[model samples]
Target: MNTSLEKVLVNVVDQHGAVYTVDAMCERSNDEPNSFGDCIRCINIDDEIIKPSLDLHFHSNKTGKVFKLS
Candidate 1:
C-alpha cells in the first residue's frame, strides 16, 4: 500500500469572499533578512488576482479559522 500525506496550504480571503492561496506568496527578501515585506507584496499580488472589494483577512489552513479584518 502506498501512503502519502497531502499538502495543506494556507489561504487568505477578502471581505468579498475572494480566496487566495498562500502558496502563491512571493519569495523571501534576500536583501532584508526576516522581513515580511515579501509577504505584503504577495498579498498585493493576490489581491490583484482575486480582486476583493472590502479589506482582506487571513484564513488559517491548519485551524480552519477565519480572522476578521478591522
Candidate 2:
C-alpha cells in the first residue's frame, strides 16, 4: 500500500477575504527569509505593517474549498 499524506495548500487571506498563494505572499513580503512560516508570522504579528490583518487558512486547489483558520 502506498502510504502518503495528501498535501494541502496553505494560503493567506486578507481582511477583505482576498486569497493569496504562499509563493505570491512571499514575493510581496520581500523579507530576508522569504519563507512560508516567516511570512505568515510577519503578517500575523500585532505590529504587522506589510500585510496587516492577514490570516492563515487551508485552500484546496482541487476542490476550491477554503477553510478558515480558527
Candidate 3:
C-alpha cells in the first residue's frame, strides 16, 4: 500500500536466474532552500530498504521459456 518509493528492475542471465530491483526514496532536507551542500549532509545512510515487486520468466532452450516458477 506504500506507493511513494521508486524502483528499477534488472534481469540477468544465469543458472538460478532471478530479477533484481533497485529501490530508493526521495525526501526533503531540513535546511535553508539555498544550502545545497548542507542538504547533502542531512541524508540518512543507515537504513536498509528492500522493495517488494517482481517480474520473472524462465530460460528456454530456444527462446528461454523452460520452466514455470514463482
Instruction: Judge candidate 1 against the unseen true structure and give its global Cα lDDT, from 0 to 1.
Output: 0.39
The segments of candidate 3 whose C-alpha lies over 4 angstroms from its true place after superposition are 4-11, 16-62, 65-70
The residue ranges of model 1 lying beyond 4 angstroms of the native Cα positions read 1-8, 16-22, 43-70
Q: Return the TM-score for candidate 3, rounded to 2 decimals.
A: 0.16
Using lDDT as the yardstick, the better of models 1 and 2 is: 1
lDDT of 3 at 66: 28
Residues 1-70 of candidate 2: C-alpha lDDT, one tens digit per residue: 2222222334556445766544222232333434344344222222222332344444454444453432
Ten contiguous residues minimizing lDDT sum, candidate 1: 44-53
Question: Poorest 10 consecutive residues of model 3 by lDDT?
Answer: 37-46
Candidate 1 contains a number of clashing pairs equal to 0
Q: Of the candidates shown, which would achieve the greatest lDDT relative to the real structure?
A: 1
- Give candidate 2 misplaced runs (Cα > 4 Å): 1-9, 24-70
Model 2 compared with the native: what TM-score? Answer: 0.23
Which sequence of candidate numbers ranks them by lDDT, best first? 1, 2, 3
